[model samples]
Target: MKKINLYITLKQGVLDPQGKAVQESLHTLGYTAVKQARVGKYMELIVEDDANVEQQIEEMCTKLLANPVIEDYTYIVEEGIVQ
Candidate 1:
């Protein structure tokens, strides 16, 4: 068996209005000095095999997991032993 970890983040040049809103709200709530913030996505998947997993995960990210036009995604695949 195998496990996949996916991380998706906004592209460098993309603006994150949601993150900014959260930061502003935090400041108003007395948690100042928060600086800047960005939102991202994390996902995990359990699969049966490791072969070509990276390619497959990348394709999944491109096709459905992430918005390639505004975000970037990366993943790691690891072997899982099922006893």
Candidate 2:
């Protein structure tokens, strides 16, 4: 089996309203030292062992896991026995 960790975030030059809101909330709560805050999505996927796992993951990301217009995605694959 393999474990895939996917992280999705807004692309550069894209406005992140959620992040801005969190930063403002933090400032209001006295965390003024924070310059900025960015929000992202993290996902874990388990798949059957296959030589083409990486390719499959890339296809999945492009097709459904992330928005190509405004978001960027990266993933790490860990191969080991499934627990």
lDDT of 2 by residue, 32-78 (tens): 99999999999999899999999999899999999999999999999
Off by over 4 Å in 1: 81-83
* Candidate 1 structure quality by residue, lDDT tens digits, 1-83: 88788899999979999899999999999889899889899998888775677788878888999999999988877786473
Checking candidate 2 for backbone clashes, the offending pairs are none
For each candidate in turn, the TM-score is 0.87, 0.95
lDDT for 17 (candidate 1): 93
For each candidate in the order shown, give its overall lDDT on alpha carbons: 0.87, 0.94
- Which 10 successive residues of model 2 have the least lDDT summed? 74-83
- Model 2 vs. true fold: TM: 0.95
User: Residue 76, candidate 2: how far off, in angstroms?
Assistant: 0.8
- Over 4 Å off in model 2, which ranges? none
Q: Please report the candidate that would top lDDT against the real structure.
A: 2
